[model samples]
Target chain A: MLKESLSSFLRGCRTWRLWTLLGWLDIQQRYARSSLGPFWITLSMGVMVGAMGLVYGTLFGQDMKSYLPLIGSGFVLWALISGILNESCFAFINNANFIRQSDVSLWVYIFQVLWRQMIILAHNVVVIVVLRIVFNVKGYDHLLLFIPGLLVLLLNLTWMSYMAAIWSARYRDVPQLIASCLQILFYITPLMWWPHMLKKHQWIITINPFSSLVDLVRAPVLGAYRSQLAGVLPLFLL
Target chain B: MAEAGDGAIQVQCLKDINLSLDKGDRLGLVGENGAGKSTLLRVMAGIYRPQEGCVKREGKTVPLLDISLCLDDNATGRQNIRLRGLFLGLSSEQISAHEQEIISFSELGDHIDMPVRTYSTGMRMRLAFSISMAVEAEILLLDEVLAVGDSAFQAKATARLREISDRAGIVVMALHSSPAIMKFCNKVAWLQDGAVRMLGECHEVIRAYDQFMHSKEKTDA
Candidate 1:
């Protein structure tokens, strides 16, 4: 099972070039008739963050620069997680033709969705970058670590996408259940909050599969990492 | 009882499961809706492995399961023909040489540059059928997918299919319209309730299927 999943994901990643182009094809197809085109995602993200960040920044008594990265990082990571989970659940079902007919590898469709999300997230990052500059936010030197982290997250997400698509295709209920779990995890996750402030129950943040993921990547990017941040390995971070 | 629940399709939905076709024969499958007719063709095409018995194919099996499996809706018709042809099992060079023939055959005109989504369903089928012909594979399987074309276009499409079968491919078309079947297929297999009720001359199987239905009605009454 592991070998199959691994092979499927590797095939998926290798097809990244074609699928990424296909993902762009879909984006054009989706947004072509509309007036706004592809900015709908980033536009909506901007509106939501501006409102929430203003209200929450005051509530938390934080500056926009400091707070915006918190929101920016959270949103980027959430988009990655949410996009993968949302699309993978229906991957096989949606590509029934490719599943039943295409001679090419079935894993190509998984990469198709993952690349689609990465593209959309790349668009949304423009919003985040704009917010950071607009708010005078400073970039973390360790932000360079995000390149590796993004690489790792994508590698893992490819595996998850394959396993999820195949699993959901068979079990029937796994897709719906996974969708709800993702929604709940978004709220439970500190998307807009500081990880350190949850000192009383930081374990909740630390134990999350995405927690290590977000901490290792996002904190460093937002320049929020303390000297002790490097010591924050998987288990002991909380 | 050819039961296959775990993704292993063992039962060939073909009933009667017996037929003999001379070389260069065109046969249609005609029946009412929900008939096991398409399943029969799929079984023949190796898309659905039969559960109960076995199927023998002297040549390769290819089915028009979907158009986009070969052509993405957003791609140009020119590219789609090559893509779809390659998908149907042609090598890239083979696809390259045949691309022009399929494109011109589609009669898509200047619209060939447009994405396939802009084309009507009939036009899409035209493009799909033309590409399938280019592959030069034996044993063609289609399922009422031809009705999408205009009547004149249908005649040309039928002629292309007929010519291909005459040269090589063994044709098995699952259709509901008896007239269309008669126009194309010299042999027909009648299927109902996942069993082959008759497999013989097109008219004979049609007659048998009709009689069976009439008897069923009398019994129900």
Candidate 2:
């Protein structure tokens, strides 16, 4: 069974063309009737970040320049992390017909979910770019670190998605259970609020794996390094 | 075998089924509803793993079970061709090469660029049949896909199926129609209650199954 699973994953990776086109078709079908197309998602994300930045920046007593970049990049990363987790629940259920009819690797559907979220993340990156330009965020020195960080983050997400897909395929309520858990996770993760806001309760951020995963990608883009969180990431990988 | 809640009961879909075929073999499966014909086909297609046995297969297997199930209604007929082709393991270049042939065979004309949701049932079947027949298969597994489209297109589809089956190294089809089975297969397996009740020449098995059905009907009457 382990050998079969490994070969399935390798076959899925080799068939990148299928998943890439499937992902693009998913986005196209979603916005088929809309005027602005998929940009509507980016536009809404930008509006949310902008509005939250203004309100929370004041509420937290942080300046706009630094706060906007922090929330902007962090929110984009969070969207990707949460999107993968949520959609992984349906990765097999959504393609149940194909699963029953074809002999293709089950990993194909999991990769489709990840690829679709990546496309959405690509669109949401526009908001971060606009924020960077407007706020003159100078974080080029550590930007290259984002590559390895993002790879490690995606590696963790891939396994999580695979497990969720398997479990959700068997149990009908797994998707609903995951959705509710993610709702709580969203509030606890350091997206709109900074980790330092926890003050003496630093263990909350340290214990939450999502915080470390998001920080892996977000901290690099913000030109900050969390060596402590980086130490925790290899543990999650195991 | 599949287990229900808490593994209290197991529903065995197939059991003790030992059948083999070689190159150029065309085998047909016939059984009553819920008699494990589809399950056996799925097992051969590698969709379901048997709990107590194994299915040893060689060559590439392409299943044409429920051809319309993979079509995206929101995408255009042209795009769905590419999509279905990709799902069937055809590379983009291969799909592009066969794109025109599929469109022409489906007879969609200008409507090929329109969403499949706008198609009539017959049109949808035609598109599905065209795309499915375009696949090159070494071991072709089919499930009741013969009766598709209108009568005219049904004749065309039959001819296409014949051509593809002839080219395939092995063909296994599950069908209720005796005529379809006779037309495509030289060997037959009659499944009853999750086991092979009869396996022999197509004519011999069908003849026995027909007599058994008639006797059961008379007993009920």
Candidate 3:
């Protein structure tokens, strides 16, 4: 059974063309009949970052020039990670019909969710770029680090999705449970606040896995690698 | 094959089953509702796994258990055909090769450009049947899909099935109509409560089955 399942998982990965097409279909069907379609997410993300940057920078007494870009990259990457993890829970359950009738692998559905989330992440990239330019965010030439960071984050999320898919298949309430946990994780993570602000409570940032994951992506984009050691160390260990 | 629920309660949909077939063999499955006929076909097609036993099958098997195998109603009929063909292990080139054939066979000219959800049930069935028939498989497992379509289309589908079975390596079908059994199958397996009660030549087993059903109905009356 172990060998069989492993081969099936591998086979699912091999059918990239199939899952890629299905992923596109998923988005097309989701926003069917809508004028804006999936671009709505990109537009909304842009508006959200703009509004949050102006208000939060003033409340925290920080200059919008640097603070806006930080929050923008953090939130955009956070949305991608959380979206992949949350959607993974329903990956297998949603494909019950295809699973019961066809010989398609279970991993195909998980990959579909991953692929769809990646598309959304691609759209969210525009927000990050616009904020970087608008705020004149300057950093070291470690921009290449962003590629590896994003790839590692994606790798971790892929396995996490598979784990969630397995556990959620057995427990019907797992998806809801995951959603609530992510809700709490979102608040605790440093998406909205700077980690330096919590100097004494720095353990909150170190102990939380989401903090590490967010830093892996955000530190590269923002070029704050020295302070992101707490995030990078754990990811390297993983 | 057993679908386990909660705790120790396991509903064994099929058990103590053993059967084999060779090239050009057509086996008809007859059973009442929930007697595991469809389950058996799925087991044969490798869609379901049996806990106690294993099924060893050679060659590709096309299972027509559901006509809308994975049809996206949100997608146009042409897209649906392409998607369904991909799921069936066809390459883009192969699907493109058969695209014209399937479209013409379904007789959905301009309608093929429309989403499948816009098509009527019969139209969807036609699209599914056309796409399914276009694929070439050594083994075919069908579950009462012939009961689809209007009388005319049904006749046409039956003839197509006959032609495919002649060239296919093996054909296993779960059906309710005894006449369909007599006409299409060479062997019959009668299932009762998840186990095979009788298996033999189509005529002999079907005759015994008819007699049993007749007497049982009279008694119930």
Residues A1-238 of candidate 2 have per-residue lDDT tens digits of: 8898799889999888878878888999999889999999799999999999999999999989989998998889988988998999998988887788877788888899999999999999999889888988786888788788888889889999998998998887888998898888888889888888878888878788888888888887887866545555576746
For every prediction, compared with the true complex, DockQ reads: 0.24, 0.72, 0.70
Best by DockQ: 2
Judged by DockQ relative to the true structure, which candidate is superior, 1 or 3?
Answer: 3
Off by over 4 Å in 2: B1-9
Q: Write the per-residue lDDT of candidate 1 for residues A1-238, one digit (tens) a residue.
A: 7897678557655655456555666677788778888889889888888888889889988877778768876887888888898788788887776556543467777877887898888888887688667766675677677777677667667667877998988888888888898888887688878777676977787567776666666766776553333433332322
Docking class of 1: acceptable
What TM-score against the true fold does each predicted structure earn? 0.75, 0.94, 0.94
Q: lDDT score, residue B52, model 3?
A: 84
TM-scores for chain A over all candidates: 0.86, 0.95, 0.92
Q: Considering just chain B, what TM-score does every model have? A: 0.82, 0.89, 0.91
What is the model-wide C-alpha lDDT for candidate 1? 0.73
lDDT of each model, Cα atoms only? Answer: 0.73, 0.85, 0.85
B1-221 per-residue lDDT for model 1 (tens digits): 46577865454344556665555777777666666776666666665656667878887556775545356887778767755654455666787788788878888888888998898888888888888878776777787788778888888988878887888668888876766776677787776666666667777776676677689889999
The C-alpha RMSD of each candidate to the native structure, in angstroms, is: 5.5, 2.0, 2.3
lDDT of 3 by residue, B76-95 (tens): 99988888888888889999
lDDT of 3 at A166: 86
Clashing pairs in 2: none
Q: How many residue pairs clash in each candidate?
A: 14, 0, 0
